[model samples]
Target: MSGYLMSPRQFSALKTGLFLLCLVPLANLVYGLLSDTLGANPIEALTRGLGDWTLRFLLITLAVTPLRRLSGLNWLLKLRRMLGLFTFFYALLHFASYVWLDQFFDWAAIWKDIVKRPFITVGFASLLLLTPLAATSTNAMIKRLGGRRWQLLHRAVYAIGLFAVLHYWWMVKKDITQPAIYAVLLTLLLGLRVYWMLRRAGAR
Candidate 1:
């Protein structure tokens, strides 16, 4: 583990690199729109592209702990906050696209869709749940809330992830292949948590 661990300079560089790499997806989306490269349904493409990245980031954030534990790379914990924030960032963009592009700021229709459509409802709820996670992501907030309470609050992420997966699943009613892949990945991530919890309890 020591051999594999990164130096301060190396870690800083890696974090910067990861941060920039994360923005590439949004950059590509912007390029697609500006260059008129996105197909006929550009709005749909943009919205789905943002939503897809949100899910990807969410899964990546959740995997950090397990990866850190397995690989004995404790510095991975430092990256978790950035990854989680990016998850919320993408999710915000996704929700914003749905409200602005898809609904055209038609609050009435948006409200109705949230109420009537299960997928929209789930997606909306996921965003709602993510709001506080993003808000309290700061070190100041962590100190103010206390470590235990902060952990409890952020635990809502598990539900958010499940709802996110369900939202994607229900949205693509016919072709569920992508959603299923996310579901399986999420299941494994969560399964690892459960296994660790049970192992700790047994040790106790």
Candidate 2:
């Protein structure tokens, strides 16, 4: 795909818009908490809300690659790291809610929950996997790791995405609607990636 540059001013405006847009969820959550409007099960609601946004942001982050390739919007790449970090940020909140509210800092209980509950097991493992990705997201780390190695490490996102969807799918036993939607989105993203890989191999 041919690349066209966006002007610095235009790019700045877009970034600003995305920054605010990303904050909208957190703002809404805070408002809901303060107003006691997050339904009767507030902690569960907050945990679910954060988890939902984490999945959404992960899908959005993964979309940037296909979006840029298809649309020739190279500037979209700039937002990938930010979107990814937001995924981790929300994931942290989801985990924290579980730890503080549900587990109450009970290490033994938490460990038992992680080991005993398959959903929690995968969810906790996914969060642990995400930690290094989030830590190594800096430009400095990329430079230090070298392009090839950094790319290799970041490929974990695909696995993380799958694990995240599985976590959600397992958590929701009855109403599978939300998890089903996320599964479709993830399938599309993974499919696009596979298509591009095959295309590249064909070209070679």
| TM-score to native of every candidate shown | 0.97, 0.95
Error of 1 at 113 (Å): 0.6
CA lDDT scores, all candidates in order: 0.94, 0.92
List ranges where model 1 is wrong by over 4 Å: 1-4
The parts of candidate 2 lying over 4 Å away from their true place are 1-5
Which of the numbered candidates is closest to the native, going by highest lDDT?
A: 1
Model 1, residue 200: displacement in angstroms? Answer: 1.1
The superposed Cα distance between candidate 1 and the true structure at residue 73, in angstroms, equals 0.5
